[model samples]
Target: MNDFELLFDPIREHYRTTFSRIERLVNRRKNYSIDDAYINLSIVESKELSSKEENFHSDANYTTFEEIYGTKRPIEIEQLFNDNRERLLVLGRAGIGKTTFCQYIVCQWASGKLFQQFKCILWIRFRFLNDTRYPKKSNNEQYTLTEVVENECFSNKLTDDGLAVLQFILGEVRQAVSNSLPTILILLDGYDELSVCEHLQNLIDSLMKSPYQILTSRPYNTDDLKYDAQMEIIGFTNDNIEKYVNNFFTSNEPQKSKQLLTFLESKPSIYGIGHIPITLELICSTYGEENKQHAITSGTTITITTVYSKIIEWLCRRYLEKFCNCDKRHLNLKDRSEIIEDCSEILDVIGSIAFKAMEKSSLILDKTLVEKELRKVSPKRPSELRKKLLNIGVVKSLTAGDDSTNVEAAKDYYFIHLSFQEFFAARYLVNVLQNPKRKCYTKAINFIQYEKYNQRFLLVFTFTSGLLSGNDSLSCLETFWKAMTSEPLDLIGPRHIQLIIRCLEEAGSDHRIPQRSLWIEHISKWVECAANDTRDHKPLQTDSLAPN
Candidate 1:
């Protein structure tokens, strides 16, 4: 047999097993399988990207280039990879399906539907690798590509014979590479999550030199990275969004699905945001639950903050139903009332943990840390609460241990999505501000004024401002305005001022609030500050503040 055939023969079974294992693991962790949740979207070729450019600024020409080369003629994901045989970088905004695209590629490859030219494929999650610690070694020591593959891929479920076959394949591939023949495909996912180091950079550089390699990252300044070609994962089109919603609800609950689509159709604002797959899921998941169904059809105004709030409550309700046997449909009126009260109490504790995790910049919470945080709120039954959180998909297992074992076997937990954590954090702060007896109002004010401008706290700031302005109570609006204006002019950056402007705009647009004069007054103060260029407030040259 030829080298490729000999290497592929024994490992084919292992590959199939790995594919099934990954499908199950991803479905379990996400609480939905890709086949069910994925929406096929168009890929836009980035004209500015070229392999010859040593330093490519991804965003420098983005606006002009996109206008020139609109997505009118888009390409398939497979075509993008096939055209760029050497190196490709995929970029997209958060919740735009960069990771999902990677999973889809793996699925296709495993099924022999795409990239048939590649004899071997390896997917590496940079976030997990970044968190993994390796024992110190001598300066001369280095890790090999074969070692990385064995540790990440072959370490799980492979028999001795399967492992031997993998080693033989790697050996042959290495020889082929020396002779300038391509044989492997490497996919590095989540480049932004990786903390850069010389070691990691060297590895990336080596991999980029390979004939087949792909990397995915969120939109950022990419002048430091090297790639042969680049593509952007554009979010769903209106037609695709409708199709996805139909598919999501067709087999499960057709009536509810129609109601959701009708709701989105009526509200153009909500439908605009639904173009993003993650946001669409949030909308569907919230509207699917019986308690939150009213959120869409009840004529209550829905902003991003309100949608997130409903989603948080829905998640908490799911947790309670799983752990406390409190499914509302099966409970009597009194029992339902009690269950809601219990869920409210439990939600406060989970929100506290989420707030602490956000403050620490730690997205993944270890079991010990979760227990400690839970103990702060409920001294007893922290373990039970943790299990419930996991069951409801509020917090997912970061490390997949034996599924046959208890979920407590997981070493770490993280909020299913970063947006959820931010929502809970905002909830915690809102509670603090609304409590008249609490002295944490100043703390909340300081966070919004100082820390919110940081990228890490951007979501927290957005949610906080939305919640504060969305409230009809004059007291809430007064407090938000006061805190925003009280910051010294020198301390407020352009971004901070922009956020304040946004909050004022939201308050003015909120029809429930009768007092537009108060919002106008605060808006005037900030406008004056900008007019005078006070506090070194230079006009922001970007279109980041354009109305969405």
Candidate 2:
């Protein structure tokens, strides 16, 4: 049996004994006592036995005790019952298993295995409570979180008054506690999600003072927690990641298993980031079946951006086919080339300006500068587009305080999540530069050539594509090639020129381009050097001299 199983044995026995005694007492007066009297009597009698008091709070309901501890084994039950108040806080990047860990703890506690030493377990999902539409609730019912908790505490109890059911639960809990049977353990998960609510501070204060309580939250702006112990879930270490990968691969396809591992190793930033188990599972499971063979044969990194891009691509393609086909529902919509051009121009301008700020300068530009640059294109709010960028994880939003108005600090709005930015930039570049039948290319070429624009665009494009691996495919290269060749390479410089040639070479003999052989000789020396060190910087002159 597991450690948790053994720890539960005594608690289980105690509960059994308590139930037997309560049953015996009820049997003796079954006929004489009225239903209400019996209810009160049983509650009163339960208080005397102290069946609930022994460890109700220690039962591990609301808090994610196990995840916070980073273990599955049962901890010494006595340790949690420490008299001094300590706090544990969990912090990590987005989509890095914070919430999942919290849930795992709830499952353990609910099972009555690990935290059985606690008298009562209470679990709360702060988001659900905070999200309740207070405006629609009864005018007479203004409730603090504590008041709400007091009500929910008695939800499972027997109560004659519907409005006072929660109070009844609390009463039962109090009576249970007064008996000094089991210690109570309260687990509060996603404190960050709730802490934003006006009532949350008060609720936290109440919890801190309570004899039994634990809380979990995101690390941002969540400093003060009077928890008995402070535990931060820093995510899986490299060993933990390897262990999880090994476990995951045992039953999965060999190719998908290999692909995910390759993906994990390719990017330094996302090494342990994707190992959140949820993200890894989502990426592998979503893309694994369809491309299992390809993934196995070709080493590819699965980045959060690439995963999101795949989903978006599928969505766009589906909608495009559905709305505008040769057959049914073809809304003979006027070819609003100008509108498309306008939108493309806006995106291009923003991409160019943002690229300059992110790539060329040593000093990072603030949001105000970014906004100023964007204003040159159109007066429309850039915040929405910025939000879209953040949503897709291309550029993360950083804040000084937890409040919204804080300007992004240094390295704040970068394309470190290369795959996601590639998805956006590649799409935007194609629409702007590769439209075969439009005047957009002429304007785009002119725009790109204007005053150090090439350097900015190149930096933007390269840094954004660095994180892409197998799944990114050759799409970005094709898009870039099409853009570069449409105009003279001299305007853009040799680096972009070689970039185009390199893409053509990698595109292989399938495309039947004579330019591949012609340029390969010109680029061979630099290419040979790059073969040894892919990240080594090459001179712009080398790029210009290398054919084209």
Residue 58 lDDT, candidate 1, scale 0-100:
30
Q: TM per model?
A: 0.73, 0.41
> What TM-score does candidate 2 reach?
0.41
Q: Candidate 1: TM-score?
A: 0.73
Minimum summed lDDT over a 10-residue window in model 2 is located at 37-46
| CA deviation > 4 Å runs, candidate 1 | 1-37, 47-73, 82-85, 132-147, 154-177, 195-211, 221-223, 251-254, 290-292, 327-341, 359-361, 400-410, 432-447, 470-548
Ten residues in a row with the worst lDDT in model 1? 52-61
Best candidate per TM-score, number? 1
Query: Whole-model Cα lDDT per candidate?
Result: 0.61, 0.40
> Candidate 2: which stretches are off by over 4 Å?
1-87, 136-140, 144-183, 195-209, 239-252, 266-270, 292-304, 311-548
lDDT tens digits, residue span 1-548, model 1: 66545445434444545543322111243344455555676577766533322122332112222342363357786677564357888887656677777776766676788788787677776655533232224584655555556555543544576555565555535564455443778888877555444455655556556667788876554557778777777777777877877766648688888878888889766776677677787787667666567755554455667676656556556655666677566543333235446676556766777887777666666567777876776677777666666665567766542322355744567776667787778777777777657676777767655664455555566677677665556665556545554434334344454555445443436544333454455446656656565345444322232212
Q: RMSD of candidate 1 to the true fold?
A: 6.9
